[model samples]
Target chain A: MKLKKNLALSETGFVFDPSNGNSFATNPIGLSIVKMLKEGKDIELIKKNILNEYLTDANTLEKDIYDFINMLKKLQLNENETSND
Target chain B: MKRKKITVAVTGLNAIDSPGPGVPVIRALKDSTYFDVRIIGLAYESMEPGIYMHDLVSKTYQIPLPSAGKASLLTRLKYIHAQEKIDVIIPNFDAELFNFITLADKLKKEFNIHTFMPSQAQFDERHKANLPEFGKKHGIKIPFSKMVFNVGEIPALKKEFSYPLVVKGKFYDASVAYTPEQAATYFNKIAAKWGLPIIIQEFVIGEELNVTAIGDGMGNTIGAVPMRKQYITDKGKAWSGISIDDEHLMKMTEQLFTSTKWKGGLELEIIKNAKGDYYLIEINPRFPAWVYLAVGCGQNHPEALVKMALGEKVKPYTKYDIGKMFIRYSFDMIVELKEFEKIATMGEL
Candidate 1:
C-alpha cells in the first residue's frame, strides 16, 4: 500500500502529520521518493531514478532504498499492498 | 519576622560538557518564598560566594558522582534512600531523571514525595538519535545528524553534512563534536568508555533560546518564561543567561503542551537561524536554570511552578522587565592553589 500518504508539508520543507503528530526530515532525493509515493509512483520507478542521480552502484543503491523503505514501514508511513505483489 | 519556607534544590556539575538542568535551578529556588531551601548535590561546592548553597541552604546533602553501571549508582542512591523531608524531588540532570522515575514512588512511600518526570516512552523520544525521528514526525529540525552505536560505526559515516557536527549520547549525555571525524572519534571513545549509543549532528550556528513553562494537566497553560543563553562553559553548559519575552516563543509552549498533554514544567530550546527561522533543538521536561533570573526581572517562574503544583490558583506570567542578565564569572575560589596541589593526588593514577 502507501506509507507516504497524508504527510504534512510547510514552505520550508518541514513535513509533519498532525494525526500521528510526527515530524520527518528528508533530503532532496528522499523528499522526491516520498512525494512520488504520495503520488502513487511504483517503488521500481523510484529506485531507477535514484540510481541515475546518485553515484552508488546498483546493489548499494538497492539495499539503501530497501532499508529506507523498510524504515518508513516501521514508522507506519508505508502501506502494504500484499495483493499487488 | 516570619520563619523561612521549606524548599528543595537539585544539582549536578555546572561545567563545560555538562548540558545539565540543576545548578541554575538550585540558585533560583534558593531566593524564592517557598520552603527554607535545602540542596542535594552530585557536585561539591557548586555556585559561589554567600551562595555555595551549603551556606544558603537550611540543609545540605552532598553526593559524589556515581560510577558507571548499576552498582555504583545504586550505592550512591542508598545515601539519599530515606533522607530529607523533601516535598519535591527535582531532577536537574537526565541521569537523575531516569533514576527518579523508579525512586519517585519509592521516595513517596518513605517520605511523601512527588517528582515531575516524563514517562519512559517520552524520555526515549527526547534522546538524540530519536530526535531526528521526533523532529521528522513533529516538523522540528534538529541539526541534521546520524546515529552510532559502537566504534565500528565511525568510518561508515563520511563528512557530507558540514563541519563541526555534534556528538551526543542517546539520552543523558553531553554533546561533543567539531567535525564529523571529531564526532566519530568521540562516539567511538564514549562507546568504549560508557557502552552506550551516540549521534552526530550537523552544527547550525545561531543563538540558543529556551522557553520554560508549566502546564496544567488539563489543556491549559499556567506560566512560561523565554530565555537566551549568555555564556556556555567549555563542556556545553549554559553558565549564564538573561530573560526575554516573545509572544511567538511563548505560544510554542502552549501549542506543545496542548498537543502532548504534557503535565509538568518543560523547557524547549530553539536556535534562531540567520534568516530568522527558529529550528527546534530539543525539549527537556524540567525547570531550567536561570529560572531565578526570571524572578529578578519580576516573573519568578519557579515560584509560579510551585504554586500551580500545590493546587493554588497561579497568576499567569506576562510582563518581564527586560535587560536582566546572569553572568557566571570567577566567584571566589573555595580552595587555594596550594590546596589544589594537595588534592591533585586524591583521584590520581
Candidate 2:
C-alpha cells in the first residue's frame, strides 16, 4: 500500500494531512512501516525489514502489519490501490 | 538584575478543541519579569500535548485521574514532590479540583506545596446544583433553575420553565430543549455522562460575556478582565474574543467576590438579556482557557496569584488595555517516539 502523496510525515512520528487539517501520531514500529511505504517499499519488503530489526516472529508481524495498514486506510492516509497496481 | 528561580507544578495540560487553562497559565508565568520559573506539568494522559511541549514544560509526570480519589492523588503527588520540590500547584480542571482542594491544607503543611483556591464552602455554593440559592443569598441575578434526578421529573418542568429551556449536567455539557421530550432526551444524555442531579433552567437569550478574575483571599479583587466572545466553536468554547470596556460587568464581578469572599481564579459566565439586566450563568472555579488574554491586557493575574501564594503583598490591578483581541490557533508539534515511550512506560518524562 502507498501513503497519500500530500501526507506530511515527520521523523518524530507526527502525521499531518493538509487536505483535512487532521493530525495523528503512531508508535515507533508504525512510523517505520509508514516511512518504508512512502519510499515505495512493498508489504513483503517492509515485513522483512521489521523482522530483521525487531524480535517479534514473522506471523505476529504479519498480523500487526495488516492491522496497521487497515488503520491507515481508516484514517485516509493511504491512497486507494488503482488498476495499474 | 537576576530573577529569583521558583518551581511551579500545574495540571490540566490537555490543550484540545475544548482546552484546559494550564498551558496558557504556564505561558504567562514563564513571561513574568519578577521570577524565573521551572515548570512541572502534572498530566492524566501520556498524549496530553503539553507534556510533549518540552519548551513549555520542564518535565511532566502522569498522575492518577481524579476518579481514583484524593488518597491516590496525594500518593502520586508526594512522589513528584520528593524529586521536584514543587512549590506551588495550580490545578486547572474542574473534575480534579475537589481532590486538590481536599488535600490543599495537608500539602501545604507536609510538603510546603502551596495552592490558592476557594474554600470548600465557596466551591460548593457555586456548583450548578446550588446556583439558585447562591444567587439569592448573594443578591445576584441568575436564571431560575431546578434539579431533577430522573428523566421522569422533566415532564413536570413545563410549569416552571418555558420552552427553549437549558438542560445541563452537574459538571459539564448542556443542551437547549424546546419541549419536554427534547428536554428528557438531553437529560438522559447528560445524566449518562455527568450523572444524576441534572439541572433544568430558563434559557436566557442575549449577548454572552465572560470575566476572568482573581481574588486575594481577602475581600478584594486582585484583577478582573471582561471579554466578549467573537467566535465560538460548536462545543461552545470561545475561539476568538475581544476585551471590552464594561463598568456594570466590573461592578457585578466585585460584588460576587466581596459577597462570597472568593479566593483564587474564576470565570464568570454572564448573559445580558433584552432588559439590560445581567444574569450570572456559571462560575468556573479555575482559570478559563483564555487566561492569557488577561495577561496580554497587562493584568498578569497568574503572576499575581503566584506572588500571593509565596506570601508576598500584592496590590489590586486597576487598569487593563481594552479592545485587545485573541484568536486561538492549533499547530502540529513533532514529538519523538522515544519521548512518548518514556512517559508511557515510566509515567514521567
Best by the lDDT measure: 2
Model 2, total clashes = 0
Least accurate 10 contiguous residues by lDDT in model 1 chain B: B340-349
Q: DockQ, per-model, please? A: 0.01, 0.01
Give the TM-score of each candidate. 0.64, 0.80
Model 1 gets an lDDT of 0.60
Query: Model 1: residues >4 Å from true position, as ranges?
Result: A1-85, B1-4, B7-9, B13-23, B34-52, B62-83, B159-164, B171-180, B190-195, B217-219, B308-313, B333-349
Model 1 C-alpha lDDT per residue in residues B244-271, reported as the tens digit of each score: 5455566666776666666666778887
lDDT of 2 by residue, B101-162 (tens): 99999999999999999999999999998999999999999999999998888878878878
RMSD of 2: 18.5
Q: How close is candidate 2 to the true structure, as a TM-score?
A: 0.80
How accurate locally is residue B151 in candidate 2, as Cα lDDT from 0 to 100? 88
Q: Pick the candidate with the highest TM-score.
A: 2
